[model samples]
Target: MHKLDTKLIQLCKKGNEVAQMQVYDKYAQAMFTIACRYLINEEDAKDAMQEGFLKAFVNMDSYKPDATFGAWLKRIIINQCLDVLKKRKIEFSNDEVENLKVVDDDNWDFDNSISKQNILNAIEQLNEKHKIVVQLYLVEGYDHEEISEILEIPIKTSRTHLRRGKLKLQELLKVKYNEARY
Candidate 1:
């Protein structure tokens, strides 16, 4: 943490409202964008972001310097979004993939013709579980272990979902590619 951030955080911990607002102002837009990614409704995303901020403030003592304050707040925001999703009864699968060999494919290469927006649209069409896993892994840059912890599934399940999601995403993109070629 920067010296300025540390000072602000110390003030926030001391229950200074102005300091809290300053911290919120610093991170709100970026955190809101992250919430929007996990939530479809703008209002719901806003609510989640607000709730996340409240939670962070109420639990300010727990904040540590091991990670950047933004990263810590980002986790809280994502967790709040996930809580909203849970209330909607979006099921995250717990199926064990013990027998299945999940290939860890690091390459997320799409054809040159496929735009970033096209890939994002394709990701949206995936099943909810696979979509979330793919979003966390690829878009959010989380490793399998982190994903497994976040989603409360086994590491193999995370890998399996990523593999399956990647395959489906490729298929979706290929169809789009062929259509454009014709």
Candidate 2:
């Protein structure tokens, strides 16, 4: 952590309300974006972000210097989002038990290039489980191991979701792009 962050954390740990607000002000927007990726509702995302901040403040004493404060807080925010989703009965399929081979490269070939917006729209239309995996792995820059831990799924399951999600995204984009050309 930078010197400023360390100072802020120390002040926050000391029960300084102003320091707590400073920390919240610094991280809230980014955290809200992360929450929105999962919740898809502005209200729910705000609620999750608030709850995350509360948890972080309450547990300030446990803050470790090993990781950046933002990273630690991001996990809490993600967990808050997941907790809300779980309460809504959102479930991931463990049914993809068969070992399906997935390509290891990022190379993609399309008949015609699709706009980034189109790709993002396709991703938004994916199944909840697949969408979350893709967002965490691709958009959020989390690795498979981190994804597994965050979602509490097996590493293999995380990989399967990501593979399947990409295939699904490709199919969606292809249809859209093909129609646009014709």
lDDT of each: 0.90, 0.86
TM-score to native of every candidate shown: 0.90, 0.86
How far residue 115's Cα lies from its native spot in candidate 2, in Å, is: 4.7
lDDT of 1 by residue, 22-130 (tens): 9999999999998988887999999999999999999999999998999999999998998898888987665666777868569998899999999998988998889
What lDDT would candidate 2 get against the real structure?
0.86
Q: Tens digits of per-residue lDDT for model 2 on 1-182?
A: 77998999999999999999999999989999889888988999999999999999999999898888888899899889989987887777677557666567255454546876677688899999899888887777788889888888888888888888889988898789878988
All-Cα superposition RMSD per candidate: 1.8, 2.4
Clashes of each: 0, 0
What is model 2's C-alpha RMSD? 2.4
Ten residues in sequence with the least summed lDDT for candidate 1: 91-100
- lDDT score at residue 112, model 1, on the 0-100 scale: 92
